[model samples]
Target: MPKMKSVFVCRSCGFESPKWNGRCPNCGEWNTFEEVDALPKSSSSAGKSSARVARSITPLKEVDLSEASEVRYHTGMEELDRVLGGGLVKGSLVLLGGEPGIGKSTLLLQICEHLGKEHTILYVSGEESARQIRLRAERLGVVGDGLYILAESDAQAIADTVSSNKPDIVIIDSIQTMGISEINSAPGSITQVRECTNLFMRLAKSEEIPFFIVGHVNKDGAIAGPKVMEHIVDAVLYFEGDRNLSYRILRAAKNRFGSTNEIGVFDMKDNGLEQVENPSQMLLSGRPTGVSGCCVLCTMEGTRPILAEVQALVTKSGQTSPRRVTTGFDFNRVWMILAVLEKRLGFCYSALDVYVNIIGGLKIQEPAADLPVAMALYSSLTDKPLGDDVIAFGELGLGGEIRSVSHVEQRIAEARRLGFKKCIVPRHAIKSTQKFAGIEVIGVSSLRQAFEAVK
Candidate 1:
């Protein structure tokens, strides 16, 4: 028998060290190192030996492309399908991570409801019992003979079951709870997560079965596991939203089969999560009319355009350094906008406390949101109400010039559909903005011009 050796691994990046350290040398994260048993070198040597076996190899040109684009499984949920770039590809591995009680399990069970109708699914839960899953499934109206549930946590047992049963789709309720018995490490540890994910990845590829693995998020909001686990999977998706709110946003952090810019929205209810096909309308509903520091903007998420509200509040300062707080928007970017407003627009915001927020729990990262944020700040400072039936979107430069943004026509069309009477855009987009009807489009080249248009 080989003597077991121990090693310390960083929970954040999977960087291995012979001994424990207060900080990870690789990822620069402090106190993330945990001790775990290291796999014997003989085991890896055996794996390499098996890899040397003679196998038939085909040239790239010899491979057939007939089934390349034809093989896609639609999940029956249009929102999910769009995020997956049409549909789920055969033999692909998808990792879904979210905070606890954020509906990760509910979403997977919901998918099984539609996928189970046409394809056999092996549902494996490491944390929940079969009866518990059944109870939830019954509530979600998931009834199908093709769905099979297993409550085992042993990684080897799962691989054996997949090989023998050969289901079309495999759903792992979570990767953290599953572990290899031979590894001598607790479940959710870095070593166990990396090894278990590797096992599932190999099984999914060799057997050509699609896999959906659920992962947990850490305190810092990143997936709680070795970073290598993300690289091993074909895709990484994050389910994000305020737990108190009913709306949920599913965004891809990485995808081999699709674009990461795409996002899927769902409204959580007692029945389950229902897809929001028109998120623009859902977000804009019940918006206050004739309000200061409120402006609407259109942002493109992949091919879909979404309208979101930007709001700001500027009040007299009570302290020497006025507070600058922002929610669902970048703080540094907001500060830059304030600097431009002070230097270029001649706004004296240095002595005021500024607060900015993006409505509906939506996070805006695009530069196109700059102009609207600036406008909202100006409106709040001057105590002038920007009309409810107006929309604005443009990138603001340091020189106070409004820069052109992509997909101007799409943004205008979405604003028009939402009953907005006027649109404010960059001057360079006037040519494309002319085709949009029923909405008054105003082209402006600078902040002065934008304020004049709104007046």
Candidate 2:
């Protein structure tokens, strides 16, 4: 018999070290090393696997793809479908991650009502018991004859049951609580998560069963597991928004079968998650009128155009150093914008405090927001409100020039649909040559010209 040895692994990057350290030498994350015992493999199960082994290689053109014609299972939610490219692909393993109490389980269970209509579903929960799942389903009015629930944590046992039963779809309430007995480390460890995900991935591909697994996030809002676990899955979806707030944004970080840029909006209710079809209207619901430091920004999310309000506040500083606070916007980007305003436009911001926010909790990552951000800062500094029916979308360069943005025609159509009278865009974006009847398109080449035209 061989003596077992314990090794320390970095939870962030899955880097194995003989000893523990405060900071991971691989990923540079502090206090993330965890002790894991290395158990010897059983000799009796040597070279045995439930996964199908390929007997021979075939040409790519010779492979049959007729079965893939109708391989998608729609969850009956348009917003979710849009984010997933079209629908859930067969033999695909999707990882859904979110903060605790952020409706991760609720969204999975809510989709079963529609999927159960034509497919058999096997839902496995490691956190909650069968009775608790039943209680939640009853409250949500999710009654399906083909829905099956299991309250087990053993990954090997669940895999065996799923292989024998071979349900159409499977849902793991969470991957953290699941563990195989072969590993000596406790459940949710780095080793367990990686190995368990491998097992599920193999099972899904070999059996052609789609899997939806819930994952818990860490304090940094990243999925709480080895980074390899995320790379192993076919798709990775993250839930973003405040839990106290009603609206939740579902964004995909990785998707082998779909576009990663797509997003789905949902309104969390007492029953379950209700899809927000027209997110533009939902975001502009409680907009204030005749207010300085406020501007409308039209940003593109995948194929959809969303209107987000950019708000800024410029006030006199009382402390030795001026404060620059921002929410739902990048802190460093805000500083760069302020610097451009001071350098290019000759605005004195050395003794003034600046604050910026995006309404409805939507974070704007696109450069098209630059024009609106600069406009909001100018409005706040001058204490003058622009026209309520005005909107803008153009990237601002370091030289204070308005840069052309993609999808100018789509942005103009959305602004016109929203009843905006004037649309400020980059001069180069005017090359689209598509004239909108109702909306006035104002093209500007420089920052000074944009402000002058707006005034």
Computed on alpha carbons, the lDDT of every model, listed in order, comes to: 0.87, 0.87
Per-residue alpha-carbon lDDT of candidate 2 for residues 1-455, written as tens digits (9 for 90 to 100): 56668788777666789999999899788888887665335321223663587777899998777856549999878888888879899889999888778888998898889999999999999999999999999988899668999999999999999999999999997898999997776778776787788889888988999999888876651334625478788999988888778999999989999899999999999998899988888888888999999999999998889998999999999989999999888898888888889999999888999999999899988999999999999999999997789899898888899999999989999989988999999999886576779999999988888898779
Put down candidate 1 lDDT per residue, 192-232, tens digits, no spaces. 88788888888888899989999887655133463647777
Q: Which regions of candidate 2 deviate over 4 angstroms?
A: 1-9, 12-19, 24-29, 36-70, 220-223, 226-228
**Off by more than 4 A, model 1:** 1-8, 12-30, 36-46, 49-63, 68-70, 220-223, 226-228
Between which residue pairs do clashes occur in model 1? none
Q: Residue pairs in steric clash, candidate 2?
A: none
Q: In model 1, what is the error at residue 208, expressed in angstroms?
A: 0.7
